[model samples]
Target: MPQNIYVDSYTLESLSNDQNVCNACRHLYIKWKNENSELSSILDHFKNDMYELMNVQVQTEDSPRLTTEENPTLITTTNHQVVKLQLNAASSFHTKCCVCVENLRDHAAKITSQNRDFIFFSRNIWIPEGARCCSGHLINQLLLKEAVDQIKPFSIRYQELSSSDVQLLLNKAQNFVENGKKIFSFDDPRDLNDDEYRLLTRVSRDNFNDFVQTSSTIRPSCSRSIRTAVGIYLCKLRLGFGYVTHQYVIGRHTTAIARELMCGGDSTDTTIIIIDRTHLHIQKSRNNKFERKTFNLCKKRSLLKSMMIITTIGYVVACIGSFMFNFNNNDAGITKDILLRNTSNILSWLKEHDILAVDRGFRDSICVMEALGLEATIPSFLDGRRQFSAEEANESRCITKIRWVVEVANRCLKQFKYFANTIQNSSLVYLESDVNCLRSHQSLSTTYDKI
Candidate 1:
């Protein structure tokens, strides 16, 4: 028998502190603790209940087991043991063609037996590759033979010709031939009619004589005329016009034509002078040892030969050795040549009120911008150690927002598919000119009124 434990005010806290308190008493105390006006008064009531429950020995009944019904098994008959199975059975045949309903193995075998050139297999049926019959007709050997005969010639031709040669021939065939009987003859100036001559004259007016003089003086191997070549080259630069495309447009070897145009007098107003060296992609060649000396040691080596090439914009600019040098590392060098050149050009071209926005890529370009008497605005670099001041953050955001206009302008210029898709080819001289012309025209047409 259990002793009667009456819980008094003091006994409650004492019993609560004990680790060995029974689960039923613990649960009863928790439920009674919240109901009392005074917790001390209810503690005694809970104690009496616990004592009563403890005194009585309660018995519990066990849970009953669940019953489950089993399913009936299916019986199947094999084709080989038909005599042992029931005589009466459901039909196995289906309304759809067995060749169409079953796997494609039977269809492929049937097609192969007919000696067809190719068979289209779908839904386990072999249809001639080009067949267009309704479901009403069954597969026939004679129809398959006719389809095979029709497809075999094309298949043989496809197998015999290489894809590259076929494409090349197709391209050659598509070109617009001028005169059906006459081949292209470069020697005879008389080949051009009066209208053609006038068109050439109109196009070549700016640099015709200059290019002619240059080509006459230079050896045939090195000859290029600026006047005739410049218009074509300008067409190339302004349009991202390709060599072959330029040949079609202006009738010249785009590469040779461009080189000739570049040889002309350098002071073209259309040339764009770049002040930052970081933007140019320089070509590296080990065979040209002198290129290394010119580019790598351009600053120190005064005797290094440099060429002054005229840009499409008609700016006479020196092609410094530094711009041609290939740097071994990714770190963009702060070369003085481009900065100095850009400074001079900007001072001449821009006014004090003009705003010049630049990216972090042109950190060095800011010096030139300031020297040219223009306002230079660039976003401040955020160092992780400290947060930006509110004013600085606002100013940076403003500059960034406005600077997007130039990026959009660049994107618009690249909208010409040739420039966006192809790398600037060897005929880049003419291509660049063509692109510049188109850009200049576009700028004049769209923004001239605003300016």
Candidate 2:
């Protein structure tokens, strides 16, 4: 490059003579030189900026991004982006197991398409094609439960995918969700087998379907269908306490033990019912009177009492009262009140000489039962004696042996966490209906199990 400065004759003459240029020309040259230096610096800076912008653009293009439209199956939870891959369904050659990454042993089975779907859909793990696993990890060609748990992604790889590959992945994911694994799904008829339905909900598949149909009036919510609501109810009932029924609690004459309990002159076919009271702890009420009424002296807690009537065979006949554990709600008082009120048609159901086996707590009910021509067989109390006499002990043993069934029946109900836990006051409104429903389930389930 060459620099050219045009000047008038006078300026040129002054320059040729090497004399100081005129002040006006000198100032003009200095200004021009400063402007050139600034322009050159600006150009260099612009070149460097352009280089940096180009480098950034290249890096951005190479990095994987989490765009729903571009990478539907890409999962970027942290710093590293995860690309989901599908296992090769048709590959029959594998030198090592995909799960454990161990050397291939004898009986290494090729991963089936179903197994791959199960792993990918459930475990969110992609098994590579031509992969095999030990036969022990499979059950009937499906991944064993333990093996499925062990299948986890250990390493990541950068995958270069085309548009077609991304489309294929989206299609595969949609298909797996629509037709693959489901856990206890009741909406689809084929999702679960009959036995599975029975095991989970304690109802046969046909019965469950029928129940769903019967409950069609159940309103569906946005989150669940009517069938799902019914299924959840049944499952909750099965999970909670199953109740006992009335007729099953009445003693059957066919049993040998029932005959043994009968007196010499008493008829062999006598109706015997075992009765007891079970305690359910409750939260202390805010009201002083209410809290005081519910406080139990024996347990030293606020409690409610339910009268359990059962049979010698350990079947619950009815659960009643669930009354406050007050002075007026003792076993004897509750029994007397039930008879006086003829609750559950006790007076109608009882005949002369019909036996009621109860613990000593029912001593006050003996006269009431006698007046009604019913025999209230209560365990003998020692009174002021240090111990029971031999005769009283023997008599008490007989009553206790039969009374223990009611205890066992109560235990069964309490086995469910719902009843075992303290009852909230708000739940009392539904307690009776819930108890009745439970009784029906318990009776039916027991009958079925016996068969």
Candidate 2 segments exceeding 4 Å error = 1-218, 221-255, 263-268, 384-389, 441-451
Best candidate according to TM-score: 2
- Give the root-mean-square deviation of each candidate in angstroms: 30.7, 23.8
Cα lDDT for residue 293, candidate 2: 93
In candidate 2, the residue pairs with backbone N, CA or C atoms under 3 Å apart (3 or more residues apart, or in different chains) clash, namely: 243-438, 243-439, 244-439
Please write out the lDDT profile of model 2 over residues 357-429, one tens digit for every residue. 8877888888998998888787776678899889878887777755665666777778667788987888876
Candidate 1 runs further than 4 Å off:
1-339, 342-344, 412-438, 444-451
The digit string of per-residue lDDT tens for model 1 on 362-396 reads 56656655775555556788878488889888777
Q: How well does each candidate superpose onto the true structure, as a TM-score?
A: 0.29, 0.51
Instruction: Tell me the lDDT of candidate 1.
Output: 0.32
Q: Count the backbone clashes (under 3 Å) in each candidate.
A: 33, 3
